[model samples]
Target: WKSLIRVVVSGAAGMISNHLLFKLASGEVFGPDQPIALRLLGSERSYQALEGVAMELEDSLYPLLREVSIGVNPYDVFEDAEWALLVGAKPRGPGMERAALLDINGQIFAEQGKALNAVASRSVKVMVVGNPCNTNALICLKNAPNIPAKNFHALTRLDENRAKCQLALKAGVFYDKVSNVTIWGNHSTTQVPDFVNAKINGVPVKKVITDTKWLEQEFTERVQKRGGVLIQKWGRSSAASTAVSIVDGIRSLITPTPEGDWFSSGVYTNGNPYGIAEDIVFSMPCRSKGDGDYELVKDVVIDDFLRERLKKTEAELIAEKRCVAHLTGE
Candidate 1:
């Protein structure tokens, strides 16, 4: 068995983490043979709830869970952390402006970044799950100058999974039949779910579905706005499915990609071949070799339609970065 892997989770008392913590304790993410120590980070308002969460973990009696720690300070909980899941952020209230929300969450990530830089493992893998995540991730990596920019990621796996499900349902196939459904650019409604490159049962999606109009219009809109649609139906943002996507996101990094398959993730865009702006976290197709290292999937054919969509989403991300520029030290 491998040694204990230390994980730090921010927003540990929230809905997403509420579902995610138990999965981590059960060794679903890092494998059952690998023991894990979880450090849960929360704010003062959520400390008591965090303790309740710890009590639940104890009751679960997971064999691979070696230790659990809860605290309000990131510095105290993040020490030597190997995996940091940043799932906490200020949600936009009824009257809150988008820029105001960005500034508030940007401050939170900036502090957490400094704390992680000071105490966490030099090679710690950071996944930003907070809202405006791509920009928040950029702010985080900028603050933690010592950590490699490639080590930071923003969650876009949920969007990828959503796109796949849409394709599968339209084609009357299992979800697993869809491949290469990359989410380009931001995680917001501006996100472009690239069905052009997607394949169904090893065939191009357009050829199988025979509804290029739907794929170009309704299909893209569905994936981009699925979160809001869910909230309208459920009265809350996604939690369980979001947790599953997080597992998939981490697993994709640790496991080798199939010979011709790639997964989508929001990663640093420096030197990317897609003409994306550098120094920003953007979602793109990537492949890994099971060594916790990944490279962008080059050679994706972007036609005029996909290129225009990419430019739109990229503009949104660039605008978001500008909104948090002061926090990012730009």
Candidate 2:
């Protein structure tokens, strides 16, 4: 246990929360011995449902869980928390207009951001997992002016892991053997998954595959549409892995990456590293832990082909930020 750690999970009774709570209770996400005090934040409408879930968590007798509480107010839950996982938002239901959805979530995140800035611990770390995650994260970061920009991030490790799995299957290599793969820019269909520097047994993937056209048609499309495929197959949105990716994202933030190998995360970029937009959250390679924080694993070269995809993803993120700015008057 690394002392008492306060974790506030917004949307804590939702689908992703159902999966995440057990993980946190079991200490799989954080350390096994670390005692946790969970403050769940949800809307007034969902308060009773969240309370039921919290009761179940308590009955489960999780050794590391020191306490659990459900709150309808964001300010009540945000106080003195070391970690805040922003998972709740207005999801993009079928036929919902994109602008309307963004506006709704932008409003939610903006309020939470202000609450966090006002109350959370000075060293709080935040991860926004809602749709339009990068922009939602940016809205929160911007609203929370007191928090460091570097502390806010969006979730994109799921995309990165999906890319790694696809590459491993295509290359006939163990998933562990594949290293240095990077997912650049937004967490959308336009995301750039770079294979130029990826290696299988230390051999460059580009040299081994030698099929640029195949890569363009098969690999890229598969990586981009993975979430859609899963949703179609299961007849529901992605849940378990959404929680798993949340774990992976936090682990990559606190645990050091091994030598010559790194994981991907949606993090703030300075643009020089990967030409990603400065002052905005975008998925990029990172390594970190303890008192130290995530730093971009830059120096991976981007050819013209990769550059185009990166630009497309960045454009989407930029437009999203603009939309939020317009909505919030920031």
Q: TM-score for each prediction? A: 0.99, 0.95
Which regions of candidate 1 deviate over 4 angstroms? Answer: none
Candidate 2 lDDT, tens digit per residue, 11-48? 89899999998898889878877899999998888888
The sequence of per-residue lDDT tens digits that candidate 1 reaches over residues 245-285 is 99999999999999898999999999999999998899999
Q: Pick the candidate with the highest lDDT.
A: 1
lDDT of each: 0.93, 0.84
Evaluated against the true structure, the overall lDDT of model 1 is 0.93
Scanning candidate 2 in windows of ten residues, the lowest lDDT window is: 289-298
Pairs with backbone N, CA or C atoms under 3 Å apart (clashes), candidate 1: none
Error of 2 at 225 (Å): 1.0
The alpha-carbon root-mean-square deviation between model 1 and the true structure, to one decimal in Å, is: 0.7
